[model samples]
Target: MTLLVIGGSGFLGREVARQAGRSVTTHFRAGGPGRRLDVRDRAAVLRLVEELRPDVVVNTAYVQADWVTTAEGAMHVAAAAAATGARLVHVSTDLVFSGRDVTYDETSVPDPVTPYGAAKAAAETAIKGLVADAVVARTSLILGDGDSGHEKFVHALAAGTASGGLYTDTVRCPVHVTDLAAALLELAGSTYAGIAHVAGADALSRHELGMLIARRDGLDEAALPTARQGSGPLDVRLDGTRTQARLRTRLRGAREFLAR
Candidate 1:
């Protein structure tokens, strides 16, 4: 199947493109290993989609601090994908939920407390309105390899280069990048539409996860500073039971993957 991966140079996007193999066309913003396609440019996105006419378009392009790129750019991509009848799989994050709930499912109403989360929530809403057959796969902290910024931060913290302490109260289901990519690829060919929670099986606190990473990487866990998250709801653990039941690919937790 012909596949188009947006933001292919990104951490999760790169993994998706790699796993997708030869039939995939990758698009990146600025400079990367793929054709330059800015998602922010609606006309450019439309032109590219019309020209390629890929069977599926997987959008993993988003800048956490940039609302225009994260929210409006996603809408542009979704619009083009809809116009070309391409199946769209948009990657989202668990930050969309306000940590008040214990666990979130596909049915959970997004009450984002942070700006990044709000932007993602807006993108999801726009995508659903634009593409009827789109799959909005929301995940948690992505961990795998040493490429992701999160992983880099963890490493820096372990090495004493980063000053901030890991939060013990903040909780998340950190999914491996490879597992998430595989699941997204599987969903790209399926008829499943709307929101789906695709995350790890275990819910862990930031400090707990840090300790696990430290133990796995042979770092001193005691050296890693730990603190409780501030008053704002920090628990953003996702309920991946729906995703687990839908796909044959198993989503392992941080502890499970690190043990390997």
Candidate 2:
């Protein structure tokens, strides 16, 4: 199948392309055999969509550098998906949740805390109604050998270990990029649609994840901090019941990601 991966040149996007390329004939922009088309350019996007007529359009292109530009950019992409009959897999984030002490479900109401999350939420809204065949995978902190996807916890924990201090709080479910990539492909091909939370098997605090990485890397685990009061999200675990039942590959845990 000809799968069109938007932002296939980026970190997570590249991983998605790599995973998808292993199974199907794929194409991309900015170096991949396809024409360079920005999502914001409505005319160019429409033209590219009509030309490609891809079976699946997995949108991993997110311009997090500038919030205003980011939201504007996704509008046309959503429109293009609606214009064409392509099955759209619009990647989203966990930050759309308020990070309350509760686990968010696919049906949970969104309360984005940051501008980045807000933009993604807006994009989700813009496209959900536009396309009938679509799946929104709301993922969490993506980790792997490649780009960490703005993973402050990893950096902070490593920095703390290097500096002899780390945060005791700040919890998150750090999913591996490769695993996430697989899940994206699965969602694109699956019959299930709507917002599905594809994340790590276990949600650990920043300190805990840092400790795992440190120990795995043969560094001093003691150098990392432990969970203390007033850290980060005491609980960022999203209910993955629906995802678990649907996806063939079970979502991996944070420790599994660290081992990789």
Best by lDDT: 1
lDDT (tens digit, per residue) of candidate 2 on 1-260: 56888887677787888787754434354676545766767788888878878888888878775664457666677677788887888888887776784688888888876788788888888777687668888888777753463344445555663333444565667788888888888888878778888888887766777777666666656555554656223556777788878888778898876773
RMSD of each: 1.1, 3.5
lDDT of 2: 0.73
Summing lDDT over every window of 10 consecutive residues in candidate 1, give the lowest-scoring window.
Answer: 145-154
As for candidate 2, its clashing pairs are 170-232
What is the C-alpha local distance difference test score of each model? 0.90, 0.73
Clashes of 1: 0
Best by TM-score: 1
lDDT, residue 226, model 2: 56
C-alpha lDDT of candidate 1 relative to the true structure: 0.90
Please write out the lDDT profile of model 1 over residues 47-70, one tens digit for every residue.
999999999999999999999999
Q: What would the TM-scores of all predictions be?
A: 0.97, 0.84
Off by over 4 Å in 1: none
